[model samples]
Target: MPNWLLPEFIADVLPSEARKMEDLRRKILDEFRSYGYELVIPPMLEYLESLLTGVGQDTEIYTFKLIDQLSGRTMGIRADMTTQVARIDAHLLNRNTVTRLCYAGSILHTRPSGLQATREPLQIGAEIFGYPGIEADAEIQSLALASLKAAGISGVCLDLSHVGVLKALIASDPLAQIFEAQLFDLLETKDMPGLIELTKGFHEDTRTALLALPSMYGDVEILKEAKKILPDTEGIAKALAELEYLAGQAECDRVTIDLADMHGYHYHSGVMFAAYVPGLPNAIARGGRYDHVAEAFGRSRPATGFSMDLRELARVLPAAEKRHVILAPWSDDEKLCRKIGELRQSGEIVVYELPNSRSEHDEFVCDRFLVQEADNGDWILKTAGNE
Candidate 1:
C-alpha cells in the first residue's frame, strides 16, 4: 500500500470541508453554552475497563484497543464519549446539584458504522447529569434540535422511542423473557416472519403486542393506537405516556414515534430519540436518557444527552464560503511590512505574494490587494478587478 493512502472508511478532510466542520463546531458549542452547558474535554484513550463501563459496554466491538506499554494493561481508544463524560460527573465534579456538560472531540471506531460512514467521527454533544426528571429528556431533545438549527439544518423530524415499552412487554411474559435477546433483534429489524416464528409459544396477548410494535410507527396518533392495542401493563402505559408528552412538547417540522426502536436498548434507561432531516435516510442526531451510566462509576446519577458526527453534519451543509482576503507583495520595505502587520492584527487575511512565485488557496479569495499610492507611497486597498 502507498504510504500516503489511508485505510478504508478513513480519509483526509480537505480545506473546504475542514472549514465547514470548524464553523459548525463553534456554532453548535456556542448554542450549548448559551443553554448553560459547561464544556468538558475528555481524553481520547483510557483503561479498557474504564472505557467499557455502563453505557459504553455496548461499544466494546467498536473500540480500538492497545496494550499500555508501561503498565502492561489494556487501553482502548473511546468509540463514544457519553460514558466518559458521565465518569467526569460521577468522580471528578461530584456535585450535589444538577450539572450540565458539553464536549466536542474525535472518537475512533474499529470499523465504519455504515456504508458511507467514517471510522473516525468528530463527535459533538451535551449531557445533563444528576437530574432524573422527564424534563431533562425533553431539554436534551430540544437542545439537539437547536444544535442542528444552529448548523442551519432545517426540515428536521424528531423520532421518539422508549425502551420501557418493549421491556414491559417482555417482562410480563416468562417465555418472552427467555427469548429476550432474539425478540430484541427481530423487533429492531421489523422482521415480521421471524417475529411470527419466534412468538408462537408466547401468550396470545404478548405475541400480539410484540407483533404490533413493528407497525407502531407514525405520528402522535400511533401512541393512541398503541395504548388501545398493546397490553395494558403499567410499564407499557408509563412508557407510552412519556412518549406522548414528549411528542406533544417537541418543536420541529415533524414528529415520529417508533416503539420498536431498540437502538440504545442496553444503554438508555427511559426515553430515547433520534433526529432526522429531509435528505438523510439515517438520523442526523441521536440522544436519550441513560440514568444508569453514572452508577458504574460508583455514583448513581440521572443523565441525559445527545451527540452527532460533525463530519456528517458538515457534509449536509453547502461548502463554506471562501474567505475574502487582501493580497500583498512580500518585501523588506518597513512601511509595507507595518501595513501588513496592521491588517493581520485587525483580523484581516493578508497573503504575501512571494518573489517569482504565485500563491494559491482553496479556501480564500484575494478580492482586494494593497497598492502603493504613487503620490505619497502610502499603502491603500484596491479591488482586484479594478486594478
Candidate 2:
C-alpha cells in the first residue's frame, strides 16, 4: 500500500482527548437514558438515496459520496444522523406516533474552506417523532435545558426563532429566487445593512421585519416589542408564544429571546433554537421542529431534537486527573501482583513494578508513588513519598 495522507480537515483523536470524549459521551448518554430516550446506533455508511431522502439541498452539498464497490451503486458517509433516524422511524419502526430516540456518534462532511467548523463532529442528540403542537416544542426545549445542565454547562443562553416567520416574509415571488442564498449570507454576517439592501424592493411590512431581525434579540420584552411592530403575522406570533411557553417551562434565567437567529437546516419548519456557552462562538447544541422532513420520506410526522458537539465540549472541559497506584513487587511477590490485579479490576489505576536498584526506589519516593510493599509475608500499601 502506498503512503497516504490525512485530509486537512480530518484528524484522529489522541488518547487523552479520546478518554475525555468517552467520559463526556457516557455522561450525555446517561442523561438521555434518564429521560427514557432509548439509544439507537445508525449505520455510519448508508445508501445515498436513503440518506438523502429528506435532507435539504444545502446540507446535501456537504455530504461526502462515493461508489460502493460491492453493489456498484452510490453510497455516502452519514453527514447527519438525524435524517437516518427519520428513515428508521418512518420505514422500519412503522410507528405513526411519537418515538423518543437518542444517539451519539461521529458525522462526516467535507471541510468547507475558510471556516473554523469541524468536518468530523461528535454529536449526541434525541429525536421525538410524531408529536406536534407547542407541547412537543416545549418538551424538546426542556430536555435541551436538562441535557445542558447534565453536561455541567451553566448560564446557557437559548436563542429561539421560527423558520416560518422568515419563510413567510420572504415568500414573495421575486424575492424567492434569491431569498435562501441572500438570507444565509446575511445571517452568517449578522449584517443588518446588507439585509436591508437585499430587501429594499420588498413589501414594506416584510422589509421592516427583515431589517428588525438583527436587533430582535434580547429579553422577553423584545418579543413584546416585536409583537407591537409586526402584528397579525400568525407565524411570528405563534413562534413568540412558543418561546413564552418555553421560558416559563425552562429555567427562565438561562433562556433568551433571539428572533434574528435562523436555523441552517432547511427542514426546520416551526420553532428552532440554539444553546450557547460563554467561551464558544458556535452553539454547543441546537434543534427544532422539522415536521415536514418525515413527509418527504413518505411518512408524515412531527419531530424536534437537539444535539451536542462532544468534541467542542471536551475541548472546554477541565483536564481530568487519574487516580493511580504503583505496585512494587519483590522476587517472591507473585501473590502481590495478583492482589494488585484485583484492585485494578475494581477500577483502580495500577502500575506494576519493574526491576529496580535503590536509586529507583528513591525516585519512586520522590515521584509520590502509591506503593504496595510485598517483601515481607504481610502486604502493605501506602504512599511512598508520605512515608
Per-model TM values vs. the true structure:
0.97, 0.86
Q: How would you encode candidate 1's per-residue C-alpha lDDT over 193-253 as one tens digit per residue? A: 9999999989999999999999999999999899999988898899999999999888899
CA shift of 316, model 1, Å: 0.8
Model 2 Cα displacement at 155 (Å)? 3.0
Question: How many residue pairs of model 1 clash at the backbone?
Answer: 0
Over the stretch 23-77, how does candidate 2's per-residue lDDT look in tens digits?
8888888988887898889999988998887667766787889999999999999
* Candidate 2 lDDT trough over 10 residues, lowest sum: 359-368
Per-residue lDDT, model 1, residue 43, is: 99
Q: How does each model score on lDDT?
A: 0.91, 0.75
| Model 1 weakest 10-residue run by lDDT | 49-58
Give the runs in model 2 whose Cα sits over 4 Å from its true position: 1-5, 112-115, 171-188, 328-334, 354-378
Best candidate (score: TM-score): 1
